[model samples]
Target: MATIRALVPTQLERRMKTPAFGRRALLAGFGIGALGALTGCRAEGFAPSAVPNGNIGSNLNIYTWGDYSDPANLEEFGRQGVQVQTDSFASNEELIAKLGATRGTSGYDIVVPTSTYLTLMSKNGLLEKLDLGKIPNLANLDPEFQDSIADPQNAYAVCKNWGTTGFLYDSTVINRPMNSWADFLEAAQNEASNNVSLLEDPAEIAVIYLAAKGYDPLSTDPKIVAECADYLTNQLAPHVRAFSSTPQNFIIQGSMTLVHAFNGDARRGYLEAENPERWKWVFPTPTANRWMDTWAIPVGVQHPDAAYAFINFMLQPDQALKDVDYIGYSTGLTGQRELAEAAGLKMLDVLFPPAEILDRLVSLEITEASGAWVDMYGAMQAKAGA
Candidate 1:
C-alpha cells in the first residue's frame, strides 16, 4: 500500500508528484489536476463539499490508502450528482490516530482499513455497525471473505480487496531462482546488498524474519519476537537500501533489485517496468500474510446513505472488476479472476495465485502482543541506523 506522508495535503502532493505512474494514470493519461476535476473537487485546497439533504447525500468522503481507488469509478459516481472526495492514510496506526484524535468528527463517511483492525476499531466505538440490508450486493461477495475472521458476522466491515505479502526480485540481476523468504534474505545480503527495500510496515517486516525461520509470522511470543528483531538488526538491516511501502517507484527506476512488497504493488511494478520479464514475483513458502482490506463506516459519518450507496455500487461485479484491474488486487468477489482475464489484465498468476499458494497464506490477527512486534521493528530500525 502507498503511504500518505501527511493526512490530506501531502496526499495531494504525492499524487501530483507521481501522476503518470499507476495503471489508471497511465491508461487515462491524466494527472492529479485532471483527476480532481473529474471527481468534482480541486486537488489543491480540497475539502468535503456540503452534503445536500437526502438519503444518499450529494457528497461522499472516503479515507483510504493511496492509489487504491480508480478515478474513473469516482468520476462515474459523480455523474449521479454525488461529489467524491478522498484522503489517504499511511498506515492503520495513522488512520486510528486521526479518527481517535478527532473523536469521530473527521467528516469521513467511509474508511478502508485492514481486516485485522476491525475488532479494535469496533471495540473503541470507532466504527458504525453496517446494515447489510442496504448492501444487497453483499450476496455477490465470495463466500470465503463473507466469513472474515476479524468480523465474522459482517457487523462492522466488508472486505474491499485482498492480497498477499511477499517479495520480488529482478531475475536479470540476481541470476538465481528465488522462491522463499530464506532465498530473499540471502540475496539481500549478497547480490542485492545495499539495494534492497522492505515494506515500511512493522508487522510486515516481522513476517520476513519469522516466516523464513519456520515460525508463525504472527507469533507474539516474546522470545520469538526478540529473535526476529535480532536477526533484522544484525543481519538484514545493513543491506537494506530503504524501508518503504511504495517500492514500485524504485522498481520502475531500477534503483532496487529485490524488494519486500505486497503482491499488488509488485505486480504493478513488474508490469510498469521497462523490461517486465526481468521481474520475478514469489508467493513465499512455507507461509506469508494474506491480508484483506475492508470498507467500514466511521462512527460519526455525516453521509451514511452515500456511504452505503458507494459500498454497494463498488460491490457490483463490473465496478469490482475495474477496482481489481486498476489496483491489481483481488476483490474477494466470486469469478473475479475470470472477469479480470476476460478484461485482458496482465499478470493473472500474481494477482490471483493458485490454490496451493493460497493454502500457505495466513491471516494476521490483532492481539495484545501486536504492540511488541511494532516495538521490535522500531528497535531493529534504530539499532541498524536505518
Candidate 2:
C-alpha cells in the first residue's frame, strides 16, 4: 500500500484545499491529515510482516468516504492481527477516476461506492467477485438490502450503509409549518433567501426541482435535463446561499438557515446544535433519492483474506451498532431499530423514518445519459456563478 510518510505539512495543506480532501478533513474533524502524516505509526509491539505475491497478507487498505469508519472499530480489527490503512474520496466520480487510471491496480483492497455505481464498475473489470462463503455474516443483513438491482447475486458488492437525501432547517428562523419540497422552495425564496444552501452534488440538486414538479428525478431525456437545468440556473440558484455537502458546521454555526443535506449529516447537525429543538429535518413530500454505499474489493486486491475478514467483522450486530452510533446511518441489519434504541441512540425517528416516508424513497441508477446530467449541472453552476 502507498504510504504518506514523505508528505510535508505544506503538501498536506494543499491537498486539504481540494473539495474531495477538504470534505473528508471537515467530517473527520481534521484527523484525516493527522492520520496520513502518522501513517508509519503502529500499535504497541505490533509489526505486520509483508506477504508474498498472490498470498493473504496481514494488511488491508480501504478507500471510502470521510469519517465513515470509526477509529475504535479499526483498532479492534488491528488487535485481531491485520493492520489497516484508509483513504477518502468526496464523490463517486473521483473514486472512478483514480481506480480507472490505475486499471484497478490502486492497491486498495476494499472500496465503498454507492450501489448505483457497482454494476458500472464491475462491468469495467475494476471490481472482483466476492466470495460469499467467506462472509458468513451476510445473513445478518436485512432482506431488503439483499438481491439489490446493482448486484442481484451479491456477486461484487455488499451494502455497507444507506441514507436519504433531504433538507434541514432552523425552525426558529423560518417558523412556519414545513412538510414538503414546495414549502422548502417557498422558504428559500422568502424567509431563507440569501441564506439557503444546497448540496454540491449535481444529481442531488437536480432531484429537488425534478421531484417537486412530479417528474422522474433520474430522467436523462435531453428535454427534461435541459428544462431542469434552466429552472435551477434561473429560478433557484439566486436564492441559494452556497453549494456544499458538509452542512453540519454551518448548521451549528447558524450561518445557513436552510440546507439540502443527507440524513446522517442532518441528524448530526441537529443533535450537536445548542438548542436541538430549533432544528427540523424533513423527508420532503412526493419523492427523494435513497442512496446505499457498499463494500467491494478492487480487481488488484492483495489481501483477500484480510478484506473478507474485515467485512464479516463489521457485519456483526455489536460492531454494526458501533458504526451506526459513530456515523449516524442505518446498517440495514435485521431489527436495527430495536438494537439502536437499546443502545440509546438519540432521535430514533430521524434515523429511522416511518413506513410512509420509507415507501417514497427511490434508488438512483446510472445510465449512458448520466453524462448529460453532469453537463447540465455544469451549465447550471456556471450560470448561477456558483
Candidate 3:
C-alpha cells in the first residue's frame, strides 16, 4: 500500500531527509521548535483568552498512569501544604472505564486522560471546567497543544506529556533488520514466532494494522474494525507470547525478542538494559499514533485549589523536565524541553520527534468501532491466554 503522506510543513520538509531514522540513540534530531522553539512545534501563545478565578485549597486525590507521574513530584506536592494522594491505571482506557463507572464519586480530584479520551470524558460531564487563571503555566505550553480541537478552549483537559507507540526489538535475537509493519508481523510468525509480545491495548495494535493497510485508525466503520479484530486474533495471536501495557521487563530483560511498546517504555528499556546496544526502537513510516496524556479534574473535585495548584506546579519548567526525564517521555512545554537538553537528556527528541511528523501522526480515539475493537482485543487476549 502507498504510505499515507500529508502535505509537508517546511520544518518537516527539512526533516524528511531522515524522517523515520529511529535507529541510534544519538542521531541528532530535527529541531521541532515545539519543545525548544521552532514554528508549529512550540506550544506558546495559545493560552486561554481569559482566566477564571479558581478557589484555592489543600489536599488532592489524583489518578493517572501507573508510572507516568513521578512520586517525588507527589511528595513535593504534599510538602506544599496540600496533602496529596494518588492512584493509577495501566492504560487510558482502564482509567476512563473505572472513572466513568464511579462517576467522580471515587473522589479523585485530578485524572490524566490522553487527548482522545479527554473529549468523551468532558462531554460526559465527568471532568470539571479548568480555570486557566489558576494554571498560569498554560502560557508556557506550545500554542499547538494549548489549542486542542478535542477540548477546545482548554475547558476540560490540559495536555502536558505526549508520546508515540511502536515496537522495540532485540537485534541480537533477530538478526534481520525490521522496519515496516510487514517486517514486524513476519518476524512475529517466523523467527521470533510465538516468542514476541504485544501491548494489551487493542487500539495500539489495531493502529499498526490499519496504517499498514492504508486505513485510517480513527475510522468508526464496524466492518473495518471487525476485520482488524479478526486480523489481531487469527494472524497475530499465535506469535504473541504475552500482552501487557507494561512490557518494560520483556524487552529490557530479553524475555521477548520483540515487544510492542510505547516510545518512552522502549527508551526506558534501552536505558535500563544490561545490553543497551542490542535493543532498538522503530516508528513505522507514513504514520504512528501520537497521543497526549493530559491533566483534568473530576466533575466534583474534592480539592479544586490543590488540583489547579498541582497542575501549575507541574508546569514549572524544572518539574516538567524531571517528570519527562523520569518517565522517558517528551513534553511540548518548550521551557521543559530546553531544560532537558541543557541537562543532557539523551533521545528526548526521538521520543518527542519534530512537529512535521505530527502531520502524519494519527490520533486514535473512541469511535463507533470501539465495541468491535474491544471484542477484537478480548479475542486476542483469549487466544494468548489459551
Candidate 4:
C-alpha cells in the first residue's frame, strides 16, 4: 500500500507554473513519488492489493477535483477504520497529461475525470477494473450510470457527479432571455460583446462550436469536425472577452455578464449572491452538452480494495445526496435527485436536460485521429490570448 504524506500548497503552486516537472514535483511532494521508488512500480506493473485491514485512510490517497471530498467525510471514514488523504487537480487535461507523462509512477488510488477522458484513459490501460464485490453501496447509483459506455460494464470508472454546460447571467441586462448556443455566439459578437466568455477547455470549446452549427458535439466525422472548428473560429473569435478556465471569477466581478459554464457552478454562484434574485441560469433551448464526472482507479494502484471502499463510501445514497447538494451538481445516485428537488432545488430539465437537447449534446471522444481538432483549438486559444 502507498504511504500517506501531507500536500504542500506553496510548492504545488510553483510546480504548477513550470510546465515541466510540475506533476512529478507535486506527486513527489505528496509521497506518491516515494512509493514509486519503493515499489519500482511501472505503468504496466501495478496490481491491486488487499483492503489493508479496513484502516483505509492510513495510507489511502485520492487525486480529485477541488473541494469535492470534505475533511468531515474523511473523518467519518477514519471512524470506520479508514484514513483518507486527498489532492486536487483543476482540469481533466491537466490530470491526464500529467499522469500520462508520469508513466504510472503516481501512488494515487483514485482519479476523478470527466467522461471523455475517463474513456480515453481506460482505453489506454491507464485505469484499473472495478471489483463490484467491494462496492456494495454502488447499488444505489442511478441505473442510467451503470453500464455507461464511457467505461462499460463497470470496467474502469464510476459516475461521481453530473451537470450540463450552459450560460448564466443577470436577467436585467439581457432583458429577454438567451436560449441557444447561437444566441450566445451572437450576444458575444453583438449584444453582450466583450462582456461574454467561454470555457477554456479544448473539448468544451469544440462542443460549443459543434452545437452552434446544429451538429453532434461528439461526431467522429472529419468533415463535421473541420466545419465546427472553422465556424467557431469565424463567429466567436473576436468578441470573447477571454477564454477563462474559471468563468465564476469573472462572473462575480461583473466584468462578464454571460459566459458558457457548468450548471452546478451557475447555481452555486447565484446562491452565494448578495442578491440572488438578480441572477438566472439560461439553459438555452438547446444546451451544448451534458457532462459527467467520474471516479476511477488508475492502473498500478497498490491498494485496490481501499480504492473500491472509497468508491463505495461515496456512492451511498445518503452520501451521494449530500455530496451533490454540497457540490451543487446532480448525483448519479438513484434517489438523490428527488431528495435534492424536495430540498428546494429548482430541479429543471436543465439538470437532467431535455431529451431533444440530450440528443444534440455530444460526448467528446479522444482518438489518435483527433489531432486536427486539438491543434485547431490550441491555435484558437493562442490567438484568443494574444
lDDT string for model 2 (128-209, tens) is 9988877888899998888898899899998899888888888889998888888887898888887888776667777887
Could you give candidate 1's per-residue lDDT for residues 1-386 as a string of tens digits? Answer: 12222222333333334323221122332311222423453233222222233246578888877767877788877666688887766556556767777787989899988887887788777899988878878888988888777897799999899988888888888998898998999999999988898776667788888888999877878788778878887788878877775777777887888888888888889888898788888888889988998999998999898898888888889989999988888898999999988899998999998999988889987654566655555565555434
State how far residue 20 of model 1 sits from its true place (Å): 19
Predicted structure 1: clash tally: 0
| Tens digits of per-residue lDDT for model 3, 1-386 | 11112212233233234322211112123222111101112123322122243334456777765545666766665554456666655445445556666776878888888787776677667788888877888777877677676788899888778888778887887888877776787788777887888775667788878877778888877778777788778888867888765677776677888888788888877777888888878886668787787889887787777788778878877777788887787667865656777899887656667767667777777666655655666578678733
TM-score to true structure, per model: 0.85, 0.86, 0.81, 0.79
> How many pairs of residues collide in each model?
0, 0, 10, 7
How far out, in Å, is residue 113 in model 4? 2.2
Q: After superposition, how far is residue 347 of candidate 1 from its true place, in Å?
A: 0.6
Query: Which pairs of residues collide in candidate 4?
Result: 56-82, 56-83, 57-82, 57-83, 57-84, 179-284, 179-285
Model number with the top TM-score: 2
Q: Candidate 4 residues 178-280, lDDT tens each?
A: 7777777766766676677777555667766667777666677888877777766755665666765455555565667677777776666666666666666
lDDT of each: 0.76, 0.75, 0.69, 0.63
Q: Of the candidates shown, which would achieve the greatest lDDT relative to the real structure?
A: 1
User: Which candidate would rank higher by TM-score, 3 or 4?
Assistant: 3
Candidate 2: global Cα-lDDT?
0.75
Model 2, runs deviating above 4 Å: 1-17, 21-56, 383-386
Global Cα lDDT for candidate 3? 0.69
